[model samples]
Target: MSFSLRPQPARWFELLTAREDLTLAVETLARTGAVELETHSETATPLVLPDLRGRLEEYNRLAQHYQHYWPQDELRPSNLPGRPVDTFNHALQRLYAWRDAADAVVRRSEALRGELYELEMLREMLLAQGDTPLDLGLLAGAGPALAARLFVLPPRTHIAQIPAAILHTSVHGKVHDFLLAVGPPAEVDLLEQELTLHKGRPMHLPPWLQRGTDASLAALDQRTAAIQAEQRVLEQQLTALQEEHRLVEALGDIARLEWFLTHVEALPVSETFAWVTGWTSDLDGKVLQQALDRAQVRSLLRFPDPPRDKVPPMVFHNPWWAQPFELFARLLGTPARDEADPSRLLVFIVPLMFGYMFGDLGQGFVLLLAGLLLGRRVPTLRLLVPGGLASMLFGLLFGSVFSREDIIPPLWLHPLDQPLLVLAIPLLGGVLLLLLGLLLNGIEAYWRGALRDWLAMDAALLLIYLGGLGLLLTPYAALAALTGLFWYLGARLQRAGGDLRVLGGALGRLLEYTMQLIVNTLSFTRVGAFCLAHAGLSVAVVGLAEAGGHPLLSAIILLLGNGVIIILEGLVVSIQVTRLVLFEFFIRFLRGEGRRFQPLPAPPHKTERT
Candidate 1:
C-alpha cells in the first residue's frame, strides 16, 4: 500500500492575557515551539513596541568585533543549559557597559599604534640617507625663510640643467637622490611640482635635522624605543578582552529574542488585556493551554479552521521502512495539501527501473556491500540495498554471473540476445506509469474540487492513453472521445470570455500532452540499451583478456575490467533511473507547492558533549 501525507492541520486561536502576565505568556509560547504567530491588531498600523532595536544592533556590532576571540566550546558561562533566564534589562546594561569600556581601550590602542607606525616610517627614511656624506646641521641652520626638500629621481630622467639652489646630488642605483634648498614657500612648491612632472618621487622631510647623519639616526632610535614600549602595553590590554567572548555571545542571544518580541503585534483589547493570535498543531494545542495555565495567566483557546490564505505548513508522516525515500521526494518539493506524496511510489519503481538497466550478479553484490559499508556514515545511501537486491534477481533471470554468459544457463533470454523483447518491457512500463500518473492527477483534482481538471483534461488524457495502447475496444472510439473533449474545452474557454487565440492555446495543450506520452515512452528505451551495453562492454573486456596470451595477465585484466564496469556502469544506471522517475514520472502528477513545516528556534549548538 502506498503511504502519503498532506499538509498538517492547524487550529487558529486567540489568547487574552493580563498586561502583567504578558512576558510569561510570550515566553511559554516560544518555549512550546508550536505556534506560528500572526499579526493581531484591529487597525492596520502596528502598535509601538519596546525600544530594543538599538540594543540588538549594538550587540551585533560588538559580537562581530570580537568574533575572532570567541570561545570555541559549548559550555558558555552565560547561556549554559538548565540555567535560569536572566532579565533583559540587566543583561542589556551589563553588555552596554562592557562594550563602552572595551571600545575606549581599543580606540586608545589604535591611536598609539598609528603614532608608532609613523615614527617607524620616519626612521627608515632617515636611515636611507646615512650613506650621504653631508652636514645635516647646515641645512637646519639655513633659517626659517629657507627650506630644503629631498627628491628621489629615477635613473631614466637626466638633469642636464641644474639650479644653484641644489645643494647635493648622489646616485643610489637606478634612483638619483637630490637635496635642494629653496628660499620662501612659493619657490619650494614650484620646485616640487617641476620634479613631479619629471616622474621624480618626493620624500617627506622630518622636523628634526641636527649635526651629521649619524647623530640624527641615534635620535630617531631613541624615540622609536619609547613608542614600542607603549605599543606593548596596549597589545596586552586588547588580548585580555578575549576572555570576555562567552559573555558577549550570551548577551547576543538575549538581545535577539527581545528584538523579535518587540516586533510581534498583539491586539489591544483593553487597557489591561491584549489578545495574541496564532496557529498551532493539533498535538501542541493542549500542551500550549497547559503551559498558559501553569503560568497563572487567564486565557481562552479556540480551534477554528484556518482561512484560505493561511495554509498550514506540511509535515510528511511515513512508515519507518519508507522514511528514507522521503529525502528524494523533498528534493523535488513538498507536495500540495491535496496532492499525492511520491515517496512510496518511488520506493517501488526506482529499484525496478535501476535493476533492469544494470543487471549483473557480481556487480549487484558489490553494490550491496558498498551500500551497507557506506551506510555507516550516511544513513540515506543505505536505501541502495533494495536496488542492488533487485539487480541480482534480474541477473538470475538473465542467467549471467560476472557478465560471463558461459558461467550460467539462461532462464530467460539475455539482454543482447533479444533486444526487441528487452526494449518492449521498459516501453510497456512507461505507458503504464503514464496512465497511473493521469489517474492520480484526476483523483487529486477531484479531491480539491477542481471539476474542470478532474472531469475534463485529466479524464480525457487517461482514457486516450489506455485507448491508444489498445487496452480499449478500438482506436477510433478513443480518438472520437478525445476530439469531443477538446471541442468541449474550447467552447468552455470561449464562454468564459476567451478569444480565438486562447482556444487555439487550449487545443495546443492537448496536442502537447499527446506528444509527451509518445516521447516519454520512447525515452525509457535507455533502460534496455544500457543493459545491452553492459553485456557488450563485458564481452570486450573478455576479448582483451584473451588477446593477452598469459593466464595471469588475462585474469588480472578481467578483474580490473569488471571492477571499472561495476563502479562506472552502476553510477550511470542510477542517474538514468532517477532522471526518468523524477522528470518523466513525478512531474506528470505531482504538484509540489506546499511549504515545509518549521518549529521555533532550536537550542544553541554545543561543541562539547558535557
Candidate 2:
C-alpha cells in the first residue's frame, strides 16, 4: 500500500507467448488484473481468425428479440476447454440450433394466446344473451356456405327502418342496436346487401363455433385449454433445448469474448510469437508471477527499467481507513509519479478542520448516523463518520450540544468566551501546516533528484517563513533578516548558469511568494472565525426559541434551528475545509501529471486458475 507520501509505484513489463497460447496467456494476465496490455495491432500484422462479426451481430439481434423466451437460468460468460475464437463460433452455432428448434413453436404459441383472448370475450358476450336454451348453430351457422353474422345498427338508423325480410334477432341498446342474421348462402348475401342500405356492420366469427349452446360454450373452454396445453408443450420443448445447448449462458460468454478479442487483436504479432508490453503495480507483478506459474501457460514475463523518456502509469493504494479520502486528491488530478500524494495527510486534516468549524455533539451524532446509513448509496457521505467523530470530540472540548453550552463543562475555553486565543492558535497552526507542506515539496523534489534546485527556492522560503514567525512572537528580527539574506544569495546561486536572471524575475516571484506565504498563514483565522459563527448562530437559535414562549413552539423552533445549523453550517464548513486543503494546503506541493494505471478488463469470476 502507498502508506507513505508517494503514490503506488508501477513498473514496466513485457509478456511473450506462443501464437497459439496467446489467448490463454492473456487470459491469465487479465484475470489476475496485473497488467495493462498495450495495443500495437494498428502497426502489427493482425491475426487471421474466422470472421465471427456476422455471427455476433446475429446473436445480438436474436438475444434482444427472444430475451423473454430464454430459459430461466443464471447467465454468465462461459470458457470452454478450447480456443478463444472457437468460443464465439461454438456459442453462435448453439444459439442458431436453439433458435431453429424453438422458433416455430414459440410463434404459434404466441399467436394461439392472442386468439384465446378474443374467443374468451365472445364467450362472455354469448353468455350475456340470457339463460333461455337456444341452438347457437341457428345464430352461428348450420353449414359452411350458410352462415350467420352479428351487426351493430346505429341509434339514428330508426330514421330508416330495417328490412323485415332479413331473418334476424335484434337487441336495442342506448347508442346502437345489435342484430344477428342467419340464412342460406344466397339469402345471407342478399341480407347483407339489403342491410348495407341501413348501415348495419357485421361482426364475424368462425363457422366452427356454430355448435349447440352447451357444445359451443364447451368449445370455447376447449379452445382455451387447448391453446394453454400447446403452449406448455412448446415451453417444455424450449426448456429441453435451452438446457441441452445452454444457449443463453453461452451467448453471455460469447458477448464477453467479443470485447476480449479487441485487445487480443491489438497486440503486435510475429509469425510464431505474440508479444505485448505495458505497466502494472509492483505487487501485481508478484501476484501475476504466482498466477502464471499456477496456470502453467506457455508464456514468458519480464520487468525492465522503465524507459526514461516515458512516465510509468500510477496506481495509488491506501489503508481502508484512508481510502475514502483519496477522493480529495483525485479532485486535482493524478499526482506526477515522483510527486507526493496529499491524500494520506488529508485524512487527518479534512476532519480536523471540518470538526473545528462544525462542533456540536448532538448534530455530530446525527451526521454520523446519516453517514452509516447512507454511505453505501452516496459515496461522498463516507467522510461524515470521521468528521462527525472529530466534531463530537471537539464538541466535548467546547462543551456544546445542539447549541446548548451549559450541558457540559468546558474542557477547553469556548470560542465565544476566548476569541483571541481561538484565533491565535489557528494562525500559529497554519504556519506549521504551511511549513510541513513545504517540507513535503522538498521530499518530492528529492525523489525527482532535484533537491539541489529545491533548496535554492522552497527550502529558503520555508526557513524565511519560520524565521518571520519567530520575529513576530519573540525578539528574533535578526534571524528573520538572516533568512532574507539567504534567499537573495540562493536566488543568485540558482540563476548563475544563465538559466534565470535573479534581479529580473526571481526577486519579483520571491517577493510575491513571500507575501502569499504570509497571507496563507493568516488565512487560518477563518477556522476560528467559523467556530465563533457556529456558536453565535446556535445562541441566536436558543434566543429565538425562548422568544416564542409556547412550549411546543419553542421545541419546534429548536429542532428547526438545529436542523438548519447542521445542514447549512455543516455544508458551509465542508466547503471551507475543501478550500483550505485545495488552495492553502495542496497548492504547496502537488503537481498533477501522472497517468492512472488501467489494467485489462477480465471475466468477473476467477476462471483461469487451476
Best by TM-score: 2
Error of 2 at 354 (Å): 1.4
Q: State the local distance difference test value for candidate 1.
A: 0.66
Off by over 4 Å in 1: 1-37, 40-51, 60-70, 76-89, 92-303, 307-309, 327-332, 365-385, 399-413, 450-458, 471-512, 541-567, 596-610
lDDT (Cα, tens digit) per residue for candidate 1, span 209-248? 5566677777767766876787687667655654443344
Give the Å error, residue 301, model 2. 3.9
- Listed in order, each prediction's TM-score against the native is 0.59, 0.75
Task: Give the local distance difference test score of model 2.
Answer: 0.76
**Candidate closest to the true structure, highest lDDT:** 2
For model 2 the TM-score comes to 0.75
Tell how far residue 309 is off in model 2, in angstroms: 5.8
Clashes of each: 0, 0
